[model samples]
Target chain A: MSALSLHGIRKDYGEARAVDDITLDFPDGQLTALLGPSGCGKTTLLRMIAGLEVPTAGTVTVGGRDITRVPAHKRKFGMVFQSFALFPHLTVRDNVAYALTIAGTARGEAAARADTLLDLVQLTGFGDRRIGQLSGGQKQRVAIARALAQEPEVFLLDEPMSALDAKLREEMQVELRLLQQRLGITTIVVTHDQREAMTMADRIIVMSKGRVEQAGTPQEIYHWPATGFVAGFIGRANFMDGVAQDGRIMVGGVALSLPRPAQFLTGSAVQLVCRPEGIRLGAGLAEVNSIEGRVTFVRDLGPVRDIYLETRLGRLVAEQSADQSRVLAVGDRVHLSLPPDALRLYPGLPVTLPATALAAE
Target chain B: MTVAAQIGPMAEVPPALRWGAVVNLLLWAIALLLCLVPFGLVLLISFGHKVEGAGWDWAFSSENYLRFFVGANWPAETTSLYLGQLYWSMRYAVVAAVLAVVTALPFTYLMTRQSRRAQARWLVFLLATLSLSEVFIVMGWDIILSNNSGLPMLFAASGVTDWLKDTGWFDVLRDWGLANPRNVKFKTSEFATVLTLSYLVWPYAVILLYPALSRLDPSLAEAARTMGARPWTVARTVILPAVRLPLMGTTLLLFVFLLGAYVAITVFADPSQHTTAVSIYENVRGSTLNAPFGAAQSVVLLVAAGAFLVLGQRLSRKSQGGA
Candidate 1:
């Protein structure tokens, strides 16, 4: 029942706005990721929510209580920092008991509780071991156990999987998500890795330049991207610039049609978005709204092959399942189908990208 | 040495060329020799015997050892006076060194929490004061506690002497020998000697403990704070236990350094309350003019210092191994 909310939050460091006016919320018992490229204010927003950083102008409410000025210690929100931050001097048992002992619990009782929590995190016999003795994954698990020792109202993790290797990262991702789901703790994770965000979060908040560009389930953000930036950031998308005319957009000699007139002013320039996964290779230009191009490169990624095609409109990369009957190699001529329904259009500017195209791309 | 061409292959090198690795090796060798020769001489001379009048004889003997332990009048005269001075020397060094490290721990922790620029500036300031000669520090305290220009003077000038006289607290100062008939005085007092000794090593204590305390992960303390510790509790639980080893090691090194102190003790201590270093000075180059006796005392102090250093190192190794 304790949901965390932020409204019109802004954090400025001198002349630069690290987190420009951004408003968002995390419903109780749900995991939301603040995803973006580095320096895009994702971590800044998460730190603000944790009360570690004070926002220049905004209100942060947790369970309907204003915590805008509340210090981090009083918030009691368990946090796992990127480095794990386990106390090097303490044994595993003492680190886990840190919360209970500090809160005036009896020594024996605190030790017992620490053991239970360690057991929960699967670090049961590691009590007497020093933090430095543990592997990267084990240390992160201890960090998680230490954070939960206080039974914090909300959980916060900042790039928790980044320190591990690729295989370990994947395993911990599933383990952590399952742990979060089992506890039903309201959690927020800050990460720039889209795959990581997609793996753990129930809803992903895609952010750019200190603003929430789009917020939705990972599936929604991936399939029905609200902006070109979302499409490019959440996954890969091939973009082509053109001008909208009636319900169709002309790109060089090829005229790409849309299901309806893109919501834009008449005669406005636009950019069209088509995902590589949806584009079919070796389909004749006449078969669908399509383009004719020469293959520039081919990437075989085990199960699928990415065919890079160069056209007068520009270069586009399309993914074809490796088992597909037709095979395209680098420098081979191929036709790519750009169906009208799959193509999302947005207005474009001469310099900056069109706002609508940001969602579609 | 200045003309490379004149010195053969070592010479045909450029003017700066003699700065070859060979020269670096020679430079290092000379550096080690410069530092070690005098101490080596002291070790050799500790075995030599004293002659009549002014000079000493060079002969291997255990007389110096026997003299140091039981005294010159020992099996026959029965004097433990010099050995007793050595005992007080160790005692005072232990207490003052421990006191300095205990106080420096918190101050160093606070200093490291400051920004890097601030830390550099502080290092400069502390190093400046730390490298200052001990003679100067004793002189400054000489003024402050001289009864005419310092704390006691201000106390009397402000009627604190009269107030203490009325409150009967002045009796405690008198009983402790911290006062004369009219007012409180720190001259020729243990309090003044210990204070100066602690101050002499206080900066050193901070410098010695700096790297360990500075590199301490801030996140660890923050993690403890988030776990519901108050500021004091965080320091007690996280900071203190974390720096305990360095704290003990710093104390031991400072104690070894303080064991050889002479100026502070001479300036502030009564003649009857003299330390072993003063006695060593007398035997080596002062009135006694007995170099062998002085070398024996040097060996004693060296042994004490070395033993403590080894103990500290062993303790550090033990802690590291356990970790």
Candidate 2:
């Protein structure tokens, strides 16, 4: 029943606004990720929810009860910091038992609960180890166990896997997600890595410049970005800036038709984005929305090959599956088509085009 | 076979190693001559006998040590006069050192939380204060604690003394020996002695504690708070435990530094409550002219300080192990 919700949360640091007015709802028993680049206010938003930072103007409610003015210690919302902030003086057992012990739980009962949690995190027999004796991954596991010892209604993690290596990070992401679902505790994770968000989040909130640009399920956001910024940030998107005309976008004298006409008035600046995998290159493709292109470079990524092309519209990259029979090398001529359904159009010119696109022009 | 071949080139010492050895030898020589030599001379002089109305002579005797523990005329009359001075010395140093550390800790913790620029400014100000000689600081306090021109006068002029009398707290102050019939007094009192001693070591305690406290992760406290501990609990459970070693270390250093403090005690403390340091000064260079007794007193003080330091080290180690 502890569904956390924020209304009009804003934070200002003297003359600068670190977090803008924004409202969001985190449903019960769901995991949401606040995904953004550095300085995107995602961490600030998480801290505000944890009651560590007071919002300039907002109400933070849990299960319809406003806890806006409550201090962090009284909120009962457990948070894991980016640095894993484990107390060096305490052993792993003492660390995990801290919340219960502080609340006057008997020593034996707290120790038993800590043992169970250590086993849950697969860190059994590590209770006696000092913090300095553990590796980075082990320390993060201890931090997670300690945070969950309170059985908080809302569990917050700020870049929980950031200190881990690539392989370990991926493994821990799945492990953490499974644990969260089993516990069915409402959770919110703040991370800058897009893959990390996509891997573990039930819903992803993409933020930029202190404002949420879009919030939806990962698939919805990835396949249908709401803005040019979201499209560029979420996944690899080949962007082409153009002017909207009668039912089409004109880019470098080429009219690329959309599945449906854009809602913008004619002569308005617009940007079209297509995923690299959406660009079809072959001998026979529909003439409409197709352009003749020359392969400029080839990149092999073990599972897929990326082919860079110079087209009349601009420079573009196309992803080719490894199993594809035909292989395109540099200087090869091909016809690439932008499927009308795959091209997402947004009003306004892109702030900056790709360097390759600029060079091609 | 390869290991053997590799070890062949390492059999001979390189020129750099040779030069480093020479420098190490030179440093040891300097340390022996500068530190150990004087310490050996002090120990040697402690056992020597004093000549009548003259300087000390080089002859082994335990008479000075006996005189310190008992009296100069042991068979007929015995008094623990020097032992009492030693007790006062220990009492003042221990109390003053603990007081300084207890107060400096919170101030240092707050300073560390300030911005880097502010912290730097505060550190510079503390270091600047360190340049004030002990004599100057004692003189300043002497004036502030004097009855005619200082706090006693201020208390009389501001009517706080009369207010205390009205509230009957002035009788309590008189019972504590803090006031006379007229107004509050501080001169030649234990209160003034400890206050000035604590003040003299307060800056040193802050400086010694700054590095450990500034490096303490603020997140430790925040983490404790998130775990449902209140601010006071966080300070007790987390912050204090994290800096326990440094706190003990700082206290011990200030204790040793205060053991020999002469100027503050001489100015603020009553003549009957003077420390072993003052006794040593009187015996050696003041009117008594008994250098052997002075050297014996110095040795006793040094031994006491060493024993306490070792005990403190052991306690800190045990606490660390327990943690």
Candidate 3:
């Protein structure tokens, strides 16, 4: 059963629609990530769910009760902002106990609850410290503890890790995921970082141009993207313009077969995407789906090597493990393989190769 | 430990640095002379005795201070008139400062929520009003509060005075000293005095509070709301505590400013309720020709202002330390 659902939510700011016809369900006790680039309406959608922004149309139901017009304070949905938004005026303990204190809880009980929450977030002894005294990661932990102190039915976070350093961000993602699971509260996190979303979310909803491009499990979003934008956004993918012709995608006179036959008319314009890791680079044994190319540049990222290749089809990047025995360098001739199972075809205007790839060529 | 080692870096010091130090010392000397000499003269005169005639001679005496605490005719005839004036000074200043700040707090908070352009426009308007001379403001209020043509006449013309009489509020207003036998009168009343004083400082209160309230992190309030705090609760928990120091500091500064107010009190307050500022004016150049006594009263007012300011600072500091 869904714990919270937004039915055909729309928000219009003047003539511009910030969130256009978004309908989604958050499964009970599951963490759903609203993933998008900046200004893609992910934050707006989250605000609408929190009752901070009223939708121009549609209803918001939680556990089958319509709460479309409920105010934010009455909704009691816990939220952590991108800046953490910790109260600098209050001590850590007071900040964490704020919701309880304002809700008319006894002082002694609220203090005890704050201490317990501090312990949960691994900051038990730092309760008396001011917000300014904590490190970025510690502040984020305090924000999480404060939000959860209310024991809200639904928890929301908007880009909670954007303010932290990259190393601390990854650690917090795992830590927050563990905490959310232990509590079993429904959660929605809005973030533009794909790795952060994939690391913490049970399901990821990809948004673009104020619309939901795709919504699925993280694995599904990664391994099987339903659109070119999703394939490019979730992870790195090399794109090539092509035409669907007779059960194959034709790219610059090369007919690349797919695991499944093309589902478009013969002359339909199409775009094909191949993940860099899925492309193999070496002196190949099979001629099927093999292309001759010259290595233009090599980027050695400790565990893997990214080989930039210029071929008749277009500029492509192939990722290979560093442990592979074949050593390739710039200006070296190579054979690149586009495995049928890894190729994804979408019907759309053909996407040009990225400038970085072309510059290397 | 040779002289060369001492002068090692100094030998390379630029000419601009040398000139800068000399200029800085000169500026400090001029500032001290300009700012401190007048106050030093006032202190000196405060201790001097007034002569018999219109002119006074300098002579060390503690009579002025003694006269301020008790009456000039000490044990024979005692009165608390000067002390009472000082008390009214503090009372009116305290109330007006607090009233202006309490009202300006919400107005400033709302103003900060506007766009930068709008905030600038408001600042321009506030500053224009703030720079209006005190004499002009007092004259304006004097007319508006006069019984013959202003609020009292308007009330009579609008039948509000008659309504008050019919509702038995006329007797209550009379008891409060707000009305005479015929109709409502505001001149020479504490209400008129406080109202004009509050209006005098209202713009200043807004200007002083704008920066702190504007820089407040709005996300903190939103975060409070999401955690089940209503708008008022958010303000109490998040906004108020964050700007507490600025609020106290602004109130203290406004209070000090009001302590020096002269024209408004003279124009609006009853003779018995007039403040030290009015007495200072009277003894110096008004009816009484006692410069030394006026200087003494000025010193007392300065001391009172200083004491209150220090007390306010200690309070703000104590609250911050406790937090």
Candidate 4:
């Protein structure tokens, strides 16, 4: 119902800082995702907001009311844990109505409200079953219903879809987004899945190393990642370490230009990022960013074909629509153009992505 | 078809599986020899008659069983002395077991919350304590509870007994038979007996409750808390219900184990309030030398314990069904 804001929040566990000094405001009735990799402190931030964890330093306020000292029980923030955490001893109805019953609502009224919430989650007639009888997705629904039973001002979910199968995760993502929209509650979801964040969050806060890397709309984050880490983390990017020379990046003795001139001191280390789709194959030789290369490998994924190129820019990847008239194959000679508008340039060297990152895609 | 065809795939079973079957049969044989055979002998002996002056005779007489319920004189007289001892046994076991579990529940929960290494250390320490013989523990408690040397002397030395008298609390203790006219007396009372029995089984209670409490997902309680339940409410509504079965099971197991407790009962309880186990020992191996009656008492005790176990199991099952 109201905006939630955190100011200068920092969490320290002995010598290690889990969440550093960070400030952000969650807009009322909008879904914001705290997106990051494993151990990136996104969950820690979410727990602080939920009042399940107290920040070692800083203040949490809801609509200008400081609640940093409040315990989770008093805050009444409905939270869905990664494991769902449904009470196995209770029936589905009781699980869903937990908040209401615990808060002293009449038994019949709480049961009625639980059934209504279950119906909202498309789990009608499942009230009599035990928690152990429900499937993973059903249990998640029960958890969501239980958290929402009190109509909490803030809704928090930590990796809510991580427990579901791949196919079910997508379905529940859309369903949960719709439910959040219908309720119009200020919701914060912490997840590592970029696609999940892009699909559901109105604004995504990308985090790394206990700090916020970038906070913006998903489109903005994808199109204009502020750092090489964000560029590599948000989506697949072909990274090339180079030196900024006169508003351009020189990688492996070849120069790449950006739409806007790179604002870095000349001869300083820089990283050039270009989405695979941003590279165009078979560009005219006279084009500004054109380079000739041999196709090292070809991957045809039905809708698109990713063509890996051995170029002066150090192993560039270009994605072409599958329906194109000319299909490039391995060992084919191709002229690729790194579109100046699509190339994103950031100061410093490119991040070294884990080798398993490629397989995860 | 040849005999090989008749034997077929069964003969092709893996060697490991065959060895497992052999081991299982050996286990069953050992169980029958070590458990069932002795029980069968006791039951058989229980039905025999006890000789007046010497050892028992193997005769098909129901007098020993009748004497357990009523006096041997039957129509001429009736007494419930043995039955009273059985009652004391049941009462002490139930009370002590309940006490042990009640006290251990909080300790075990707190212990489980500790770091894994700390929990392991505590468990190892408890298991080491279990190695202490019952006689040793009883002797230790006996010295501690002795009037001249231990708690009573401390009470007198510290002026606590005088303080109790000044505050008029000494009369309350006297009314409860926990104090004489002058000072507190713990010996020859149900309080000492129950306390010692509960202490004897306390470590077992913690060990029994450890797995259930440790395996409990902490997030369940956290979820309850976030749902507006206070800490106490969370414990009552979530933790207690989740471990209800384990708690009941631990209590019942301790109850059954304490049923035949010999040393603690003999040392702490008054002679008039002695349990069935003490009486059985007295009849068989002590001054009475009545082996048949002892065997009869043993059978009755075993049946009583088994009946209570079955009853507890059924009650837990019914509660589970209701939940």
Worst 10 residues of 3 chain B by lDDT: B4-13
Per-residue alpha-carbon lDDT of candidate 2 for residues A1-361, written as tens digits (9 for 90 to 100): 5499999999998888989989999989999999987999999999888888899998999999999989999989888988899999999999999999999999999999999999999999999899999998899999999999999989999999999999999999999999999999999999988889999999999998899999999999999999888888877878888998997899989999988888878999998998888999898899989999999999888789888999988889888998888888999999999999999998875644244322221
lDDT of each: 0.85, 0.91, 0.91, 0.91
Ranking by DockQ: 4, 3, 2, 1
Clashing pairs in 2: none
Please write out the lDDT profile of model 3 over residues A277-358, one tens digit for every residue: 8887777446778988999999998999889899978989888899999989999999888999889989866433244322
| Over 4 Å off, model 3 | A350-361, B1-15
On lDDT, who's better, 1 or 3? Answer: 3
What is the Cα-based TM-score of model 3?
0.95
What lDDT does candidate 2 reach at residue B276?
97
Q: Which CAPRI tier for candidate 2?
A: medium
lDDT of 2 by residue, B1-323 (tens): 79889777657778999999999999999988999888889889999988896788997899889999998999689989999999999999999999999999999999999999999999999999999989999999999999999999999999999999999999998887789899999987899999999999999999999999999988888888888999889989998999999999999999999999999999999999999999999988898889889999999999999999999999999999998
Residue B309 Cα positional deviation in candidate 4, in Å, after optimal superposition: 0.7
Evaluate model 1: give its TM-score.
0.85
Native contact recovery (fnat) for each candidate is 0.62, 0.74, 0.91, 0.91
lDDT tens digits, residues A1-361, model 4?
A: 3589999999999999999999999999999999999999999999898888899999999989999999999997999999999999899999999898878899999999999999999999999999889999999999999999999989999999999999999999999999999999999999999999999999999999899999999999999998888888887888888999998889999887787888999999988888888888875544777889999999888999888889988887778999988888889998888889889887776485622233235
